[model samples]
Target: MSIQKIISTKSNLVTELLQNIAIEEDWAKIEQFTIALIDNFKDPRILPGLVEKINTLPFDEANAFLVYACGEYSLEDCKVFFDLWIELVAMGDFHTASNAGFILANLPEPFDFNERQLDQAENKLMLALSKPVTEEKALVIKEVLELLK
Candidate 1:
């Protein structure tokens, strides 16, 4: 199938678990993928390089799907995972950040910090909302806060 078709399908498949966890079927393999992704985040490796290419994919859903396929990440690898989450947040892309937050929230123990731990995250979103609200960004913030709750 073409890349566009794949992305369309992936977007359909992507859903927020518990309205919190962003998951796809491949979530079963997340731990393994997380290990590798973490390693790649810290030190470049062959697989990570390929994963980077996958992440940069123009199709937004495609990139997010790749993250799901990797499975549950080990929390020990959380620093890198958290970094990715922050980066996604900083991107100021609501859909992307929402997806990233759901994934980060579901990350198994060691990685999953308390809601309080994300004081900064909450603050950031709050500040973003402090400005004139665009309907789209407003909705995104709503979705994000609900997940955080």
Candidate 2:
């Protein structure tokens, strides 16, 4: 199939998966879909639409999908993930922030962070660490902190 066709097909798949998540709240399906999508990680033609569709879901669900996307797909230009991550952090969604931080901290070669984004991430991480958080979230936060350091 043509690249455009492949992207279109995958984009449709993501949209369907998002709908299913909304109707069923089945996170397992999200994971499965993410794993499949990651196979095409290098071809990010669908990312814009996928991210937009993900944003329409509830915060928790949207965050979950985005976290998986970040972890699984290490794109060269990851402004999409970076933007969403910053937005999530600004919204005080620490769990998702941790995932985003982890992604940024481990971004692949040719994808280094700029000083301002790094500073913003550090500031957000510090703020999140000071807040009351669940044990699971604390662990994630610590992991991201260690990676950033």
Candidate 3:
């Protein structure tokens, strides 16, 4: 299956579908799509196209699953995604924030983050930390902060 098929050609509507899937907590579908992306990730065209689609998404909520799936790439392939995750985390949706945090924390080694990116991520993380979230997500955010330090 092609990446376009696995993800969706209708960039504007994919967010609604993803939001429903996230709200339903459909692990199988999410994993199925992610695995498909992983299978196709080595293809020369996948990441950039996927990143472009993600960049065009309307809101951070739309990015949660895609970001989580993309987290498996090597740092070399991951650089393109890291900035988007910073933006997602800055939006402070707990699902996206924690998933972004998890990805950031698990990078092969720390990246030299951009100053503005670092500032936004730190501010949002600290804000999200002060709010109520699942204990698990809270832990992930805390670990991400430590990783950033």
Best by lDDT: 3
- For candidate 2, the per-residue lDDT at 144 reads 64
Encode model 2's per-residue lDDT on 52-92: one tens digit a residue.
54566655635755665756665444554675665454443
- Per-candidate TM-score against the hidden true structure: 0.40, 0.58, 0.57
Q: Candidate 2: which stretches are off by over 4 Å?
A: 1-42, 77-80, 86-102
Superior candidate under lDDT, 1 versus 2: 2
TM-score of 1: 0.40
Model 2 weakest 10-residue run by lDDT: 40-49
Ranking by lDDT: 3, 2, 1
Q: Write the per-residue lDDT of candidate 3 for residues 25-51, one digit (tens) a residue.
A: 355675565455555435434455455
Clashing residue pairs in candidate 2, if any?
none
In angstroms, give how far residue 38 of model 1 lies from its true place.
13
The lDDT per prediction is 0.49, 0.61, 0.62
- Residue 137 accuracy (lDDT) in model 1: 50
lDDT of 3: 0.62
Tens digits of per-residue lDDT for model 1, 51-109: 45444455354455444433233333434556455445434455555556565656665
